[model samples]
Target: MAISAQAREILDIAVAASEAKLGINPVALEVTDRMPFTDVFLVVSAESPRQVNAIANEIVDELIKHGHKRAKMEGKDEASWILVDCRDVIVHVMLDEKREFYALERLWADAPEVPIEVTPR
Candidate 1:
């Protein structure tokens, strides 16, 4: 399944927002074209659960601010990993420990990585 241009654009914006708001290192944004529900999957990690929650909320806010409402949200309470669904794109914001435990990258190793321009915020 090829990713639509709109999905790619939203994924890019989410990535930028996560980086800017949380300052997380080695943030992994994965795009899975094969997923039937969504065209892209963004997996980002922070150092702590608090940062994970912050990044997730900020990303959702930014996406909505740009006219993309979140379709669904999960795991916000625990803050270990928060999943934000935006129809064509589903974002997973996780702490380092949770990210490693889930290993979303390895799960979707076949998907191609999108080129992202990382800027400090």
Candidate 2:
């Protein structure tokens, strides 16, 4: 499924924010048009819990500033994983360990993979 322009824009911003703050491996932001609720699903991995939380927060701020109203947020306290839902897109920022355990990429493997441009810091 092809991602809409709006969804792609949001995904780009989220990936940029994650790269700026966390500087982990090039974050993976996937666009899954198969989902009924959200048009995109962005998955980013951090090296540690603190980095995970930071990435999540940065993405949320960027999204809100870009005119997206927050739908919901989860897992801020533990920082094992954080989910930010903005109706059209859902962003997942997780620690490396958590990301491996959850394997979200595998879960949504059916959706077409969108190429995420990696920028060096």
The lDDT per prediction is: 0.76, 0.77
Q: lDDT of model 2 at residue 52? A: 84
- For residue 38, model 2's alpha carbon misses the true position, in angstroms, by 0.8
lDDT per residue (tens digit) for residues 1-121 in model 2 = 6777888788788888888886465434345546677777778888888888888888888888889775478988898888878666788888888888998888877776677887865
Each model's Cα RMSD? 2.3, 2.0
For model 2 the local lDDT of residue 65 reads 89
* Candidate 2, residue 56: how far the Cα is off, in Å: 0.9
Q: Could you tell me the lDDT of residue 77 within candidate 1? A: 85
Query: Which residue pairs clash within candidate 1?
Result: none
Local lDDT at 29 for model 1: 38
Question: Superposing every Cα of model 1 onto the true structure, what RMSD results?
Answer: 2.3
lDDT tens digits by residue: candidate 1, 5-117: 88878877888888876645533334553666777777877888788878888888888888876657899788888888887878888888877898888888878766566
Cα TM-score of candidate 2: 0.86
